[model samples]
Target: MYKRALPPAHYSLKIQSFSLLSKSNVDKYDSGVFEVGGYKWSLSLYPNGDKDNNGSGFVSFYLSIEETDKLPHGWEVDVNYKLFVYDKIRDVYLTIQDADGAVRSFHDLKTQWGFVDA
Candidate 1:
């Protein structure tokens, strides 16, 4: 992980009243659609962690391709992505990505990539 002043180049999601999500029993939240690299995408956030994925006590984040059914059959996309959390005190973003910066392949079977414990 690393810190940087610049925000994510592709897209960003800001939650103003984040604490209320847990109280309201919101297990997961998906951001509105955004386009990147000629494809639509969105951010999926598990505010209280995704228990099913063993992400308890830690935030789980993922980038999901939107409207995958619209794409051609057997379609695939390779992406190198980073997940960021804004550090209010530091005024920088804590960025996390694959340790080796691997290019993850998103296909019909796998439509998202992210950290289980972000």
Candidate 2:
């Protein structure tokens, strides 16, 4: 697992003001652009969970690849990813991921991947 310096065992993501994340407007929030393995990506938070996937009451986080149009046909990237949530009360990040650490392939047909429930 990847680790950040905030603590010895967990990664950190700081959101300045969480008041902007409302149940009715979660679709508007984004973590903006970031880079990983020379590829562009972004994170999205669904505070109310993804009801369409029967994930209500749990938070939903998604990692999405950006600028897929730049890829050539049949291009694919294999990725191994993990998702985490800071547990303020416990002061630890609640990590969620596949135990097998399977590599997922992203290509022209699929530009994004992540857990619908986390």
Q: Which candidate leads the pack in TM-score?
A: 1
lDDT of 2 by residue, 2-117 (tens): 43333222224576554456435655367888766667888777777777777787677777788887767778877777876666667898877877877678887787777776
**Steric clash count of candidate 2:** 0
TM-score of 2: 0.77
Q: How big is the positional error of residue 33 in model 2, measured in Å on the Cα after superposition?
A: 1.5
In order, the Cα lDDT scores of the candidates are: 0.84, 0.70
Which stretch of 10 consecutive residues in model 1 shows the poorest summed lDDT? 1-10
Q: Report the C-alpha lDDT of model 1 over 74-97, residue by residue, as the tens digit.
A: 999877788778866678988889
lDDT of model 1 at position 25: 82
List the RMSD of every prediction in angstroms.
5.0, 5.4
